[model samples]
Target: MLHIKNITYRVAGRTLLEETSLHIPVGHKIGLIGRNGTGKSTLLKLITGEIHPEGGSIRLQNGAKLGVLPQEAPSGPESLLETVLDADIERKNLLNEAETAEDPQRIAEIYTRLADINSHTAESRAAKILTGLGFDFEAQQRPCSSYSGGWRTRVALAATLFAEPDLLLLDEPSNYLDLEATLWLENFLRNYPRTLVMVSHDRNLLNNVIETIVHLDQLKLVKYNGNYDFFEKTRAEKLALDAAMAKKQDTQRKHLQSFVDRFRAKASKARQAQSRVKMLEKMKPIASAMEEYSVNFSFPSPAPLSSPIVTMENCEVGYEATKPILKRLNLRLDMEDRIALLGPNGNGKSTFAKLLAGKLRAETGQFAKSGKLKIGFFGQHTLDDLHPEDTAYQHLVERMGNGREAVVRSKLGQFGFSKDKSDVAVKKLSGGEKARLIFCLLSIDAPHLLILDEPTNHLDVDAREALIQGLNEFEGAVILISHDPHLVALVADSLWLVSGGTVTTYDGDIDDYKKQVIDQARNGGSGNSPSAVSEEKQPNSGKARGNSKEARKARAEARALLAPKKKAVQKLEKQIQSLQQEIEKLEIKLADPTTYEKGADYQASVSTEIGRLKAEQEQTEENWLIALEELEELENS
Candidate 1:
């Protein structure tokens, strides 16, 4: 329940939002998206009152609490769990008062409030959020100061989730997360009971967790009633129609002007020419849709090399000689291989990348690469290595050997840099532009192999798409490490798991990996029963010994007691299915071009019906999840 009316904000002599109004309904999940440097983050700050808008107003529902991820990571001495529990100030204050209250009435009121807030289960809830965010139980008990800034930032995110404010604001919550933690967060936010507005470049997250999209384009906020894909399709169709209408209007105007031009000089046709001029003056101009400049990346194709470009045998890699982070990493890379590395953060993915990039040598074992192979490595940390005062041209010049200035400028042009942009200092460029410059520098020689470590971290949705295309077009070996599932799914043909101090071929898709990660989180990290390298799982000895007469009897009784809950869940599932079918039919109607050709009233009614059905479907899904959780609790008890 947030309302932003005619808000105008400006910074650094540039307008980011100009009289743009947006309304977020209660209990709705919205994704705020735009190109990079378009002020998605700035809008979030305006809503949180971190920065005041120059005009208009922003208002939230009275007494509604707001939650935002902390700008700075925690550096205090508090334990991670304590820091998260402290987020619920009401619960903390009430529990403290309960322990010291002398009056019987006051004690009773305090306990009542604690129960209302479920304060007894607060610690477990906080731990669950922390675990989903990639902290184990033991780590949760450690002091926040013991962790790095990135890990501490995760603790701050956990606190925000534990607080469960009425309105939550997240700005690229998955920027620091791996694929596993990103999936967990997507599931968590889908079931969040309050209102949420997130700014993100991750398309999969926006499509999965969000019900609505609010796009910031041309200094305006435009709302669409669907996920990111739906928004894209709908916007494209609208623009096509606008272009067609503009064309037709332009043809009519030209004809009218031609009549006046040819006849206004003749005395006989003067009267008719004057009438035509009036007609032309009265015609209102129809604005055509202007095309925005799209960013493109072109990776030069390298000369074909022999197969098995790289081979590693029993390789151990780490910073310390005695402590190897990745052990027995036996792997091979062919000239045509496109491999995606999958695992959680701090699980040796980056270390493995460094090993391939020649940054680190094998401590013990044979690691070989083709003598003539040239590798282009793009590490996430390399973004910081850029000289702030150097221009893109200068950065390229330093690494471009004795290449001519014309040749260097041409290379920059392939990465979307214009003459003006190439001369701008690195500090003046946006994140995406800087990333493009990195690409230019790395690919200058057209290396035989490419090792990209989190290359999409600074890219927006469009820029990511461009990168996927560029990677596909490049004829060289690739090893990718990224959190963007959509990009990985498109570019990678093989999956490798770098987990549990080893590397292995993962014979499954991203979906399987997602389920494994979720299962592990749900079962306290003991759900690694799935085969790490193969789809077939080994037989469990415990399950074989678990079968007994008494166990069967207890299970039967538990099932009997849980039948009502199961029935409620099934009934809601059927209702949801029915509503989904109805919504699909309405969506199909809306997608047809003929629908928009109808009167505005008719289209409006159709859209209104779809919205109503979707709202009901959301409610049914929530009820089903609650019933399922209750059934699980009963079974566990």
Candidate 2:
């Protein structure tokens, strides 16, 4: 167990977290969530002991261990496996010492120490976890330098999981993972024996992975017992209630002040007025000080289309002329197709999209575009479509050639481009700002076919949801190439699964598509290991629990089979109770039916009702037996 007691944190002379106290119980899977710049990462660093808090203590039990996924990596082309194993060099050293203890007495002491250290067994478990996390056979030998920044972080993540510490701290862990890897991490975190805490923006991941959410707000910490969805609903209600209370308090405060002002000079009424004033002064101010600033974004609509938006025939594309990323691909895009290109990073998704958008010519085939197909492409990096030389204002103006410059400037302003920032060169923009600008550009005219490449790359979960909403509402066609599976699932109508210099089309949910792909990978097919594609173990794709359709249908069928049986059994039990009551009444009257007034008539009526009940019960019992048999048969089958 670890306790973060009365902590204060300051950065750049500004208080970040003030007098924050949190108790992390042993074996809890906690999630640290908050808006950007709210110190989620900073708090993680504090717990990891990377930085000392400005005040208070992070207390851990004696001999307790802590692990964190390093926010940044050391310079290296280190092999991925070697890098992961380095987290426990001390344990490795202990193993080495135990291996060579020479004197008999020393060896005995070494054996005991080794036995104690054996409980941690980080190295062995790390290897197993790395394997489960989708580390390919070669990952053990691959140098860390050969991997991308995301994969390098994955290497660090795998090592952290391997470290087998008492506490696991992850910050925005889903940032670089593909769906498959994220799913794996979710399952592992759920099953992890150690305490768990992480910061993430992924809604589904947060909902399923953690039991509690802690938020940092206005230099104060607030904790919620439920997941992100619960937090949102409860927080909204709390804020509304707070606002109402604050309004009432304001009204009372004004009334007290007005009375004091009107009567301060009146000798008879001065004491009563002053007493009211004191009550006003003593009243606690309400939550009127909380900010209402919301994150807002909107993109321009594109022009209408005529017909035959885009076409591709025998298209061949590749970075190298002969080494084709994709070859002999036949594809068609009409006014209604919303296509998502699916593949690993090295595959030809970007290359194929570029060909369709007319940014590049197909190396060995022909393609055509009919109608007024104005392509709005959001590339992987904002810099790809942005010009460093032009300001945000000028960029929009230049792109919208005939449009009035004033009108263009106002549109840019709508996207949070204003003041000196409107004049700043595009090169200096932040990732999210750049993404917004790209979105704005793409929105103009509602192009018939929108070709987006990693449109969600720099977007936060909230902004990504906005983009998805806009796309869903567009009525226009889309061809997007992205590695972010959440975006793919949200916007993609169908998948063009490309791999190993070939392409196959699949029609289904992104979740199902990924399941088949992972199953293929697990069975040793063309799909690269999820670990090799991105960092962080995949979150639960929700497929590993079982095939979705099969599980759903099985549950439904079970209920269907059991329903009639259950109804029949209930009817039989009610009839049995009624029959017992009637039999007792008849037995009581049997000895003196004539003595009681109208006793014979009452007995006949009761017998008739009881006979009908018994017949109906027999019929229901027969049906119940048949239904139960069928239910059992279905369950067995």
Q: Which ten residues in a row have the lowest lDDT in candidate 2?
A: 529-538
Each prediction's TM-score versus the true structure: 0.80, 0.72
Encode model 2's per-residue lDDT on 1-637: one tens digit a residue: 8888889999888788999898878988787776555677788888878899989899887788888877686348666666677677566676687788788988787667767767356555656555545566666577777777766767788888877788888876765655556666766777788888888767767787888888788787788998888887888888899889998888988888999999989999999998997898799887663553333444333455655676667877776546767786877776556677766555566777777777777678777787567777776654566887787777777778858877887777656566577788778776666777877776665566788876665655566666776665455678887656677766665567666676666534566556655565445543252221221233454453235335434544554455455555656666666766765666566446473666667767756766776676577667667766765776567
Candidate 1 C-alpha lDDT tens digits along 316-388: 9999635899999799998767788998888889999999999988898999999889999998778888999
TM-score of 1: 0.80
**How many pairs of residues collide in model 2?**
29
Worst 10 residues of 1 by lDDT: 541-550
Give stretches of model 1 more than 4 Å off.
Answer: 263-290, 401-406, 524-637
lDDT of 1: 0.86
On lDDT, the leading prediction is 1
Cand. 2 Cα-lDDT = 0.69
Residue-level lDDT for 133 in candidate 2? 54
